[model samples]
Target: MRGVEHSIQLVPDYRVHHQAPYRLSILEATELKRHLEELLRLGFIKPSNSPWGAPVLFARKADGTLRLCIDYRGLNRYTVKNSYPMPRADELFDRLEDNRFFTKINLRSGYHQIRVATEDQPKTAFRSRFGHYEFTVMPFGLTNAPATFQTTMNNIFRDILEEYILVYLDDILVYSRTLEDHIRHLRDVLQRLRKHDFYAKLSKCRFAQRKVNFLEHHVSDQGLHMDDAKISAIAECPVPTSAKQLRSFLGLTSYYTNFIQGYARYSYVLTSTLLRKNPPWFWTPLCEDAFRALKKAVTCAPVLRLPDFDCPFIVTTDASDFAVGAVLSQGKGVYQFTNKYGANVDGYSPIYTPDEWSATGDTYAAGTQGLLLWAVTLGALLLGGALLIFNTSALS
Candidate 1:
């Protein structure tokens, strides 16, 4: 089948050599052979005698099938990164505000639908026990593959982007304010994809629906909500026994930092454990308190409402001896932020002095009332006057 032509660009004076084939188990060997046979039959790849080769790796899919993948990490190091911009998740979510009807399309093996430029195909060659093969079509795990696919999608749907269509990599979201309009939008997107010979997996596609999960957030006419699965994972996480485990827990919770009020304060004790050097891992009473507080907070996270640009915002802040926190609200929805607990410099006594609180409150109040509260800077008096920056819109 005809596919979109994509080229891989390398930095000047960078060259890669062949990597020896990785040892595979008997099952892996059988899987690799099956994959090679299928790809050969489909003409997606062919026998190659290229100077550059990479070892193959197998990733198990949800269906218990192994996916053949080439380890391109070494090759990627020599490649120049494509600077093509991708649409921001926030901006994409914002476009679905008033959208009632939605359709999500998942392109089938999206990267494989694009052909590697002739001269660059050799650089993508990989070795297997059977022989060496190079991809005629673009393969997964390539550095520039995402940029190439995004560029193709953008070009294909240039006229409808941000209107009735939102394309992010291989996921295509077709949204409209009305059912009739939504159908038309979906038709237009499918027709465009057909024209370019791009195919979407029907099973994975969600037809006109009132609600859909996109970019890890549940989006609908009601507004954006944190995914329940993610929240459940956080709530069910066990107490960390080691610093590494604590770091992993922190990383997971930090993802929903915007959803949690005083996230920094809640995580302060656990974070401090990570900062300590040459010490045994110990879960203190403070750490235990923080962990439980975080779990409770995530389970009760507020459902955020879509921002209304027409309305004025309300900004509120509170400071304590341990930490400083702030909340930005519009309508009934609010986003919160806070500083670390016991964050002091030179062993300072107070975290935030009364005068500092007043000054900070005045700044926030003035900025919000004037609709110029683009950014807020809170000084940590204890940490030798370290500044904590918060973007007003980020909370929303």
Candidate 2:
């Protein structure tokens, strides 16, 4: 990504590189005038006296396809960072875990679908070696381009995201196992695209596939595997140089926190101490312990199933001065192994009580007895309620 010049250097034989036909239809003279007027309103292309100013420049995609590029290089450097989250590669991968069937759709020059507002367009204008050009739609590298695209996607997927579909801007993935449901999902996505007047690069879309590449990662029914290149990058993450580095590592580790048994306790040392303005860059024993524990936790992390919110809330909790940890388990007939070191000498296991555990070596026994007392009380209440309901139903 480096060594790419900040300036636009022309290829003398621009036509050779820009040979491919634009996938979109070229504007007729009247339409061109209308577009130019639109750009004037949007402020992307201004009226300039320079003979070479604000003419469109076209370039070929790798597949010999022409893309309309507004050379906004000079202007982009001054732009402010847009407030939007780029799609997290990990989060996207995690979403496709149980998806057996998938469809991938790529937009035909995704940014071209959007028309920059009249006043905002001129700020996007840039000078190239040959001439000045401005974007009819949003351009790449603009600080706001990502935010704009994300907003566009969020609006488009407002309805579909509630179901079994996910949209990442130009990429729309529809997933299902059953053929009937899969067909319906695919139709729904395609219909939405048509309604929006968005063009897709059909050559890039995959329909009803068992596996697919999504946001640079390969996903299948088996689950997502780290991209080979990305695995090396993660492995080569440098050791913490400062608090920022420590935080970065901790943040990355936190993404997989569900897998760790006591992540809060493990991360307590670093997260608690680093907030001071002049935090020492010392790798103390506790910090090193936390660092090692997090790495181990990542490898041994449990595979948690997606929660079923309708079911009963079953929670396991343990507390310490350093941190309190809890797992909210919803499904019936779930198993949680108690830590032997934290268990009671009496061989009785507790259901939920963090404070008692810390106070007693036999917390398992103590918690279990308390749980029994609570359960008996709950059972009596439930029995009375059931009898009352039965009497009411009989009377009705």
Candidate 3:
């Protein structure tokens, strides 16, 4: 109760009825009793006769222990959502450009550390075989739980947010350009947590590491990169034999679309299968080639460099009747963006008006008898083009 504050207020008019208790196995009953006893001892919950009640459920943890949870779906429907803003992952990653030292800290049972509003406590009541109970501290599965916690953390560390530390919910990342500076920053954050009586799980914390994984992506002084384990999973995935399986495959690969060049074009044929409404799934040769090409592209995806605003950027573009592709580069590092194959789609056309192309920079277009030249000269520009004219008989 050290950092507890009663701040959550549900809508005044909405009310929820009690849900009946769910049946539990003998072992599950015993486990529930044990957990309830511990919560009672800690003064986190108390016996209640509130009008509202939710069923209790047990979820298995990673360490092979059962975690007692409440079915909050009934109560959540009536609760007003909190619209507090949370930091974007991309913006957080963009701030780590020159940091050489890093430390990550995770708060212990983060949501439970906060207290529910006094008037709303009865609204969180849950039922089991023994009796009805209500939580004194905030519990998991609440609709606005994350927003509330994030607001609390932000208020606590508002002074040093972007300067020395970045917090996303319970995850605290301390970053610095030097080891000496990093130690001071870490100490400041720890002292603030101590002042608020917040505790961190030391076993889950990493201190003074040059490279650390944050927000599911690996980060270092070098730059940000996709997780190797995720890449391996994509490479090892077997060919899909059913519609459901094909959808799963596409979903997994699409997560890393930023890492792959021409991703949309490569997955175009595979996605067309999903649009068809017939019984039979047509696995054509074109689809097979696209699938194999995508897998190969992921395996050889380039390491994206962190952008430097002070340096000039190079934009290279190519357009054919089928597709359009572009690469934005600075020095030897590059990031590519491509549109799916189709000429009628907006911004996919090979021809662009001077005004349309001039937004990027100066526009330069030159043409000869049989060749068309469309170019934009960036600093130290390099332009190349190739045309492959083929006969219909050869393809047949």
Candidate 4:
């Protein structure tokens, strides 16, 4: 454990909430007993005598085993929120574009590696059929656990972070341009982990890989591509019979909103149906088209290319009856990230209709917005409106 520990800062007027443990079946009870014994043996948890009591339950793991989870919702309600920022996916990917070798390390029981502050241990108490117990180390389900863990990881890897290494909570990714450099970089990272008394799960770590998946993204020298396994739901998703199902589908696709151009325009029908006061839940023709189009577009999203500062960029744009769209491209193919990505969906002032968009004076303002968004990221941007004037010698 590091010298720094996770501390819970609860609201002053917080009320103490206690919960009873839910009954489990024979298999779950056996799993819980085994877990409790193991945790006790490792000095992670111990029998407690405290007024603050949360209940524990079992969630089935992918390997068909029960994972003991504590219902800390009551306790989380009164805890002060942590706002530590995690690394941006776009920025992280931008750094890996030039690297050839990659190593990803998965910390073993990341949260449990951090010790909870001594005075805050009782606050982590949870109830069980066997007895009341509390965590000595940081436990999952705490409101601020992610932020706390992120802060610790950031501090540990701050010097090398974004240079050739990146950490998001427990996942560590190290990137290098050459095999020789990768070895040196990997050694440095391992040494730091060793000095800090951290451990990695060998089964989960990938060393000197040409490509690896980190934070739901596939990375390599070529460009960015969405993981096929992660997006399988988009292909197999069924028509929604209820609002909940529709919401679930949208939530799933929302993560890759940046990958698809004019996503809001394409998915507007379903969103409007969900958000607006509506009649009975019915699958309209437009809703079906929107759902199918989104699934296809997201699944076939063009591989995002690394920015080429050596050449000029093209910003292709179009205006529809309801939305105005823009695409940032370089050379022949689009090569860019989304940190400065600008897509105006339901954003253009409705003063000009689709027919007047080209002829009207208001087109200047809308066009400038697109140019500025792309320009802010790259020093040079070509606002390719409806025309292109290039040297004829190149085409010949």
Query: Judged by lDDT relative to the true structure, which candidate is superior, 1 or 3?
Result: 1
The residue pairs that clash in candidate 3, if any, are none
**Candidate 4 structure quality by residue, lDDT tens digits, 1-396:** 488798999999999889988888888888888999999999999899989999889887646777889999999999999888877766666567568999999999999999999999999999988999999999999999999888888888888988989998899999999999999999999999998999999999999999888888777776667777657867889988888888888888877765675576766677765655665787888988988998887776756665444445444445444444444455533333231134332211110011111222333334445434433323222222323222111110
Which digits, one per residue and each the tens of the lDDT, describe model 1 over residues 1-396? 265688878889887768889999999999999989999999999999899899998998746888888999988999999989988776676567567888889999898898999999999999988999999999998888898889999999998898989899999889899999988888898888898899999998899998887777777877777888788878889888888787788888776665676676677656655547856877778879989998998897766555444544334444433334554344433333232233222211111111112232243444332222322332221112322322232121
Give every collision pair in model 4.
none
Candidate 1 stretches with Cα past 4 Å from truth are 1-3, 25-27, 59-67, 242-244, 275-280, 318-326, 332-396
Rank ordering of all candidates by lDDT, starting from the highest: 4, 1, 3, 2
Candidate 1 TM-score, C-alpha based: 0.78
Q: Over 4 Å off in model 4, which ranges?
A: 23-30, 58-67, 277-279, 332-396
Which residue pairs show backbone clashes in model 1?
A: 344-382, 345-382
Q: How much is 283 displaced in model 4, in angstroms?
A: 1.5
Off by over 4 Å in 3: 1-6, 21-38, 57-69, 129-131, 232-252, 275-299, 316-328, 332-396
Clashes of 3: 0
Q: Candidates 2 and 4: which is better by TM-score?
A: 4
Highest lDDT, which number? Answer: 4
- Steric clash pairs (candidate 2): 41-118, 42-117, 42-118, 42-119, 42-121, 43-118, 43-121, 43-122, 44-121, 44-122
Off by over 4 Å in 2: 1-99, 106-109, 125-134, 140-151, 154-159, 199-206, 209-233, 330-396
**What CA RMSD would candidate 4 show?**
7.7
Residue 194, candidate 4: C-alpha displacement in angstroms = 0.4
lDDT of each: 0.72, 0.53, 0.70, 0.73
